[model samples]
Target: MTDSGERNTMTRRTVIGAGIGAGIGGAAALTAAGFEPAPAFAGGSGKTVRLTVMGTTDLHGNVFNWDYFKNAEYDDSAHNDIGLAKISTLVSAVRDRIAADRHAPRPLMLDAGDTIQGTPLAYYYAKIEPITGGHTHPMAAAMNRIGYDAAALGNHEFNYGLDILRKFQRQLRFPLLGANAQDWTTGLPAFPPYVLKRVHVPGEKPITVGILGLTNPGIAIWDKANVENKLKFGGIVELARQWVPKVRAAGADLVIASVHSGMDLSSSYGDALPYPENASVLMAETVPGIDAVLVGHAHLEIPERLVTNKTSGEQVVLSEPLKWGMRLSLFDLDLQKVRGQWKVVARHSQVLNANTVDADRDVVALLQKDHDKVVQYVNSKIGTCTEAMSAATAPWEDTAALDFVNFVQADAVSKALAGTPQASLPVLAIAAPFNRDAAIPAGDVSVRDVAGLYVFDNTLLAVTMTGTQVKEYLEFSAQYFKQISGTGPFPSDQVTNAPTSTAPNGTPDYNYDIVGGLTKPLTYKIDIAKAPGARITDLAYGGTPVAADQQFVVAVNNHRQSGGGNFPHIKTAPVVYNRQVEIRQLMIDYVTTTGTVDPKTFHTTDWSLTSNGTPITVTT
Candidate 1:
């Protein structure tokens, strides 16, 4: 990433002598005062010590300028120009900055993971690209151009199964690190856990920086079947505690954790307690020698440079650049020698907006070449729709798009399971409203639109749940919508601020809405405080009282059934069918099966909220 403009002004460099003594407590104040001293040059070597670390995380395979769902070109102005070509420009700028600073150290580029699977490009490679030896992943090829020194593995890396993951790692130019990911049977790291580098900064002696990686432990539950045969993830904190000291003993001067986890400050989900951020905070506090943490997974930006270890009083920086090459995290650290030991004197962090920089010519060329290939492959029209197909939108209260997705998934699963003993049961499809960019407009839907709706490329999983469990599932999803009371008729102004039973006249609702089968008139009253599974009251299915033991076939993405979405009941249910079909491909199949789809065919008005024998005002 190269910058086009030169620095307009330069500050005078501070100098320090051997006789001057500075206390650790005063270092922060000194740094603030701009009294910090530059690292001394190596004796007679004319070398100055300066090192820059560049990081990117959650690059969900936005390798080309094509929109997977719209099947059209992405507008660069919409802040959607995320491609390897754009990232290369940023890398070039960083390299140029280091070159301009005569005393600056060599630069190190690192990725925080989630690079392999997101867009159609990735899907094309994973599903259609040959499994022959020396197969190249477009994302990995782009990362090579960016010249990453090392990276940590994220949970999404395992989505394609251990074989593909190993193949990806084998193809990458840089080493992939994950200290906690290990072989369960052998009790050894599945891959190299960390890498140590002796970076030479201008005007200073060489310093050893250790980069250790850890993936979220939740992969065991989320990618259970995909990884069950090959690997295991250990506790994050425990692994950090055991490894940080080892990295230090290996002569590391500074320890940086490349963690693919996240933090959440709000109490929303029942399973929010054991999130990546909480684990990260705890790891920084308990680990003895960690200096900084680079986070991913949650995909939110942590704009400030956080000082997590207040007790040790050490400044442990935690940061995350936004996902999809939308932003680049630029961490500027001032290193100074204290008693012959290198310590970070001052720190600053910022996210670079890709839209602000010019595209890297080489990266753009590479992507364009690949883009042409992908376009030709996807353009040969797999199928057609007779009518417009769309998901529900706000202020309308009903979504045809979501309903179509459920109907297709349920139908497929039911037919697949018919020969089995579970076929006799009523099947209910489980899905979430994953409106990625926005709702699909009602019209002739394209392959790109379908991709946008289900871009994750998840697999299909069939599970057996009781009718009672099905009701619990609906109640759990209803938490996303707030039921407005005392509001005017349908589509009124009050609908936006409608009060739920729990709100004191006016409060926001944090529940997810659920749609069920049409056999029963679905109705329920809100009951907060009860655990998610306990929230439903007066539940019935098809006019029959639901029994806890009554089995029903539930169709859902493999991620949810394997516990990825953190839903309560599905995680514990018995797996009845594990379809090898990819969600993206399934949508493609559905569209191709019914050429020129009408959106009305997908539209549904089966479920609604009621108050005092009157329907609550719903937008759409």
Candidate 2:
């Protein structure tokens, strides 16, 4: 046996050919970060097995490049390329690349879940014309046509319930796997744990590769209504420890983890919880036999990151493609004959921009009917906005767009709590500016406009908390802004996210909350110059100092009620009511029921940000 400079132990083959065809994403916009061109290989007297692994995560029911928000093809968002149609195009391009050169074998296509929910299109199928109700789900059909080998279940899979998830699993040709989600009665895997596949080359023996699937353990809390009595989710690391060896024992030469989770190691739900939301990094560091990890659920795009396994001191490749079908994780594996047996010589991972490729006309034709239906539904007028409401200044100031969202919740819950124990209690609602770029036209408001305001499928929950608890929640949210010192008439662009880039935009927009129903102005300043958790000051309510236990019913989404954001006091707070309906639908109902949203009546100047007793000039 002989070795070269590129084969000492582990060598990275960077460039996967002259790629990046120009489309929506120009040549300059296409980037495969941390990737280099492949070096020339020496033709030896050994069998070579060259194959590609293509993956997508957090598809969230996008079958076309159309946006339900704008009621047209997507534009001016973080991601230009969207849906399985675009992904199908990328898949063919990769296959063509392989065919042109080695033509070794067909590529393995995979997905890390969150496939069923996000847009109105997914909702239309899951709720309106369910597959169980004899309708073909668009996501399932598109993926089946694309030919997925295997997939992991995402936490959102349970948002609709077990019956719906079971129906979806049965509808697909490939197996839907979840190693951690277990049956409550038997403490056994609820779905298939892992799948083994054999790749047969023309002149070589069949090579066995195992795909292990893992889902976010937050299913226990986030979907407690759907999974509580029937299933329990275990920790990814602990469960991987149990399942990896079993898969290897089942005649697998290589193992891949299709993990529907993120790479953050810190436990967001605290250490006592069995599994925190983001633990992919921990899974790679501790688990053995895992060659690579495909991650999702945090909606981050990590082109390539190498993790060192602590047990064997071996390197494992981890890749997370951007959500909404914006990017694909393309990994190429080089296999060489070893003493008459073929083994992987090296592995290379990188992200391919979905916008760089054109959408497959065939896939679009397959789902065009479903796409048209969603467009029609979203375009229907729901009501009217008396004045223009824009989220453009929401991140910096308490804009009218947020006041409209907050008022909807506060009013709806106030009526929902009638005749209940918390009926007489004063109510306030907490809402985040989900769309930083959303704007509602002055004249007519469509169902799409209101749906765009509350992008997530969150449910409403009214929890009893003190005025002090409300202040504490606001303090937790103030952590979303950055620390800015030497303040003058600072523009709102200075009002972006907190410095921690755990996510691409630092502090996520979902964490920034604004409240309604305060008697006095809820003017608490976020001193960006100070550290998080210590930045909020001037907390007051109703023109008087708030006492520790001055109770009030605060309306929030089920995610917060399920302890999603790791905010203090909210998860442990007493719940007065839990509405199992979608909050977006409620907003739809609110606007239509009220007939008109006069910004003059609902918009409030209840919040402000000041430096040295003078408010900074915020302009985004």
Candidate maximizing TM-score: 2
lDDT of each: 0.63, 0.76
Q: Write the per-residue lDDT of candidate 2 for residues 9-28, one digit (tens) a residue.
A: 21121111112233222222
The local distance difference test score of model 1 is: 0.63
Question: Which ranges in model 2 have alpha carbons more than 4 Å from their true place?
Answer: 1-46, 77-79, 101-103, 337-342, 381-401, 408-427, 432-445, 452-513, 518-545, 548-586, 589-620
Per-model TM against the reference: 0.69, 0.73
Judged by lDDT, which candidate is best?
2
Q: What lDDT does candidate 2 reach at residue 339?
A: 77
Q: What is the lDDT of residue 425 in candidate 2?
A: 80
- Mind giving the per-residue lDDT tens digits that candidate 1 earns over 54-146? 788888787644464555434544544565656566667667656766767777777787887777677667766733345688887888877
Off by over 4 Å in 1: 1-50, 72-81, 130-133, 264-278, 308-312, 383-401, 408-446, 452-514, 518-540, 543-620
